[model samples]
Target: MAKNNEFLWRRLHSLLGIIPVGLFLTQHLIVNHFATKGVDAFNEAAHFMESLPFRYALEIFVIFLPLMFHAFYGIYIAFTAKNNTQRFSTFRNWMFVAQRITGIFLVIFIAWHVYETRWQVAIGADKADFNMMADILGNPWMFGFYVAGVLAATFHLANGIWSFLVSWGITQSAASQRVATYVTLGIFVALSVVGIRALLAFVV
Candidate 1:
């Protein structure tokens, strides 16, 4: 029973990553890309998001809850699982380690990002807009941090998708897994480009 529960939770964790969390990340990148069109366009996008009916409720269920579960359960998995990459240098093994490492980095980055943007706006201390992002990213140090964070996040999501396929038994054969890996690599590259472009829109 305990083992079954563990399996179920792990499955749920993987499902959450590809569903609401992953979908949210894609939407976030698209919205942030509007910054390239200037402040007006960016703010208009923000206003549209805010104007959605029951936006806060949607945020709680679709964004916050899933994100929190995925992160915490991920941390639990990371801590409980053994890392044998050093002993066995295989591609899949290294990717397993990389997933954990990136997950840790993302937790820190996401917390800081949410506090600086969402929490501040909620408390009336800041507004979510292009100017706010520009101010944050204008600093060289902050810009570098964002670049690193975005890359880590992109890799994590892409790799998570690959893992999700295997976990759900969608890619069972070695050939299929390899194809999924290549596809995920392509996704990582594409998302990285979009993410970096969004970041540059603020500073450049």
Candidate 2:
């Protein structure tokens, strides 16, 4: 019974990570990427999202709840799961280690990021505009932190995609898994560029 419950939870975790959570991340990166165009472009995109009907309700139900489950359960998995990187010392083993490390880091990174941006906006302490990001990223330390956060986020999502495919039985063959690795690597690189460019736009 316990094993079956855990299996279902793990499957749910995998599904949620790819569904609303992954989709939200992709939309967020795309919106932020508008920064590369100009302040007005970014602000327009942000404003459009902010103006969506039932936005708060959507965020709570679709984004936050699923994310909290994924994050918290992921933390549990990270600590409990065995990492055989040293003994096995294979590519996938190393990836497993990296995934856990990044997952833990992302919990910290995402919380701080939300506190700084979304929470602040909710409390009327800040605006969701380019200038707001500019003020935040103007500091060298914060800029470095944000860059690291972006890299971590992109890597986590990309790698998580590979895991999601295998766990969901979409990638049954070794060759398919290898292809997934390459595809996800490309996704990581592309999203990293987009995220870093957006951050650079804010500061530079």
Candidate 3:
């Protein structure tokens, strides 16, 4: 019974990471990518999202709750899960270790990000605009930190998609898994470019 419950929880965690969480991450990067266009472009995109109907309700139910569950459960898994890299160093094995590492890092990165941006906006301490981002990334250290954070986020999502496919039985054969690996790598590169470009836009 305990194993069964764990299996269910793991399944739900994988599903949530892909559905709303992955989708949201992609959308957020795209929105930020508008920064590359210009200040007004980014602000317009950001404001449009902020003005969505039932925004707060959607945020709490769709984004925050699922994210909290995934983040906390992922931390538990990260600390408890064993890796086979020591005995059998393989591509997937390394990826498994990397996934846990990135997951842990993301927890910290996301928390700081939300506090720096969302919490400030909520408390009227800052505006969620291009200017605000520009100021934050104005510091060289912060710029470097954000670059690392963006890379970590993209890698996590891309690799998570590969795992999601195999665990969900979407790609069971070795050949299919190989294909997924390439596809997910492409996703990582593409997202990293988008994210970093947005960050650079702020400092520029």
- Model 1 stretches with alpha carbons more than 4 Å out: 1-4
- Show model 2 residue runs off by greater than 4 Å: 1-4
Tens digit of per-residue lDDT, candidate 1, span 1-204: 434588889899999998999999988988888988888999999989988999999999999999999999999888887899779999999999999999999999999999999999999999988889999999999999999999999999999999999999999999999999999999999999999998998887
Candidate 2 Cα lDDT to native:
0.93
User: If scored against the real structure, what TM-score would every candidate get?
Assistant: 0.96, 0.96, 0.96
lDDT of 2 by residue, 1-204 (tens): 434588889999999998989889888998999998999999999999999999989999899999999999999999998877779999999889999998899899999999999999999999999999999999999999999999998999999999999999999999999999999999999999988989999987
RMSD of each: 1.3, 1.3, 1.4
The lowest-lDDT stretch of 10 consecutive residues in candidate 3 is 1-10
From the highest TM-score down, the ranking of the candidates is 1, 2, 3
